[model samples]
Target chain A: QQQVKQSPQSLIVQKGGISIINCAYENTAFDYFPWYQQFPGKGPALLIAIRPDVSEKKEGRFTISFNKSAKQFSLHIMDSQPGDSATYFCAGWADSWGKLQFGAGTQVVVTP
Target chain B: DVKVTQSSRYLVKRTGEKVFLECVQDMDHENMFWYRQDPGLGLRLIYFSYDVKMKEKGDIPEGYSVSREKKERFSLILESASTNQTSMYLCASSLWAGGGGYEQYFGPGTRLTVT
Candidate 1:
């Protein structure tokens, strides 16, 4: 069973536009949510993350909006650029669990 | 800075041959994980180790095993590699916390091919 589900497996947006990717989790035990950016031939790297306690967390052009009761979280890239074109994955982890559940991932492409 | 390093960036092995993938972390992390990445499948965990000499099966552990004799090194072994096992393998490390969550640091990944 897939514990975490992501929508829009692929996305295309214009430069300087907003890019959004959404994910939902079934495990209520999850407390921390993180997004990862992966480029070709490289492993996934940490992008942005949010906890259930916060409604939103932003790091520069990247933002994570979280909804605890809904079991949903979304990643938003403001002023998306060509460099932002990469696969995005959302993952969840709980304390002492030691295992992280990942979403299927979204391939985002930003056009010039 | 946290750095996780995989021994090889690419590897090829024949079917029924044993294959070993090595990973090392310089961050002194207590938790380490192995995962395989594939198209449409995202990343699936194969094994994870929380302490030296200890290991646990992740979501997909069939045909795979792990060794963690030391805190900084974790190894994934395929007793007999199969064609289906060909994929990109990633190693990650993180701090162990009983009640708090920590981010994972990932290596560059190894692309393995089984012929």
Candidate 2:
């Protein structure tokens, strides 16, 4: 069973439009959440991360909105660009486990 | 900058052959991990090592084993290659900060094709 569940397997958006991907998890022990981005021929890299102490965290055009009680989190990309097109994955981690549980991943495409 | 390098970018092996995928990290991280990425399945952990000669099984460890003889290198071994094992294999390394989640740096994955 997948510990973290992600929605919208794939999405397309126009340039300058907003792109959003959401993920939900059932484990309450998870204290850290991160989003990873991967290009066509490369490994996934850390894009943004959030802790339960804060409701939202943003870096540049990437934002992570987290809901502690709801056990859900979402990533929003502001003013999406064609160059931003890639696969995004949401993951949850607990200090006790020392490993991340990843979602199924969402492929985002931005049309110019 | 943390650099993780995989031995091969692509490999093709026949079924029933033994396969080895090597990974090395330049950051001297204490934690190293191996994961397999497949379409729609995301990345599933196969194994990880926290220190040299010490290892732990991850979510999916079947048909795979790992060796971490040195702090910088982690090797994944397939006892006998199978067609079903064809997929992109990724290696990652992270620092062991006592209480919080540290970022993991991943190598440009090795795509394995078993025919």
Q: TM-score of chain B, per candidate?
A: 0.98, 0.99
Candidate 2 lDDT, tens digit per residue, A1-112?
Answer: 9999998999999999999999999889999999999999999999999999999999999999999889999999999999999999999999877899999999999999
Task: Report the lDDT tens digits of candidate 1 across residue range A1-112.
Answer: 8889998899999999999999999999898899999987777888878889999999999999998888999999999999999999999987656689999999999999
**List of chain A TM-scores, every candidate:** 0.97, 0.98
Model 1: DockQ vs. true structure: 0.76
User: Each prediction's DockQ?
Assistant: 0.76, 0.87
Docking class of 1: medium
lDDT digits (tens) for residues B1-115 of candidate 2 = 9999999999999999999999999998999999999999999999999999999999999999999999999999999999999999999999998886789999999999999
Q: Which residue pairs show backbone clashes in model 1?
A: none
Worst 10 residues of 2 chain B by lDDT: B94-103
- Measured over the true interface residues after superposition, the C-alpha RMSD of each candidate is 1.2, 0.7
Off-target runs (Cα >4 Å) in candidate 2 are none
- Each model's lDDT comes to 0.93, 0.97
Q: In model 2 chain A, where is the ten-residue run with the lowest total lDDT?
A: A91-100
Model 2 lDDT at residue B84:
96
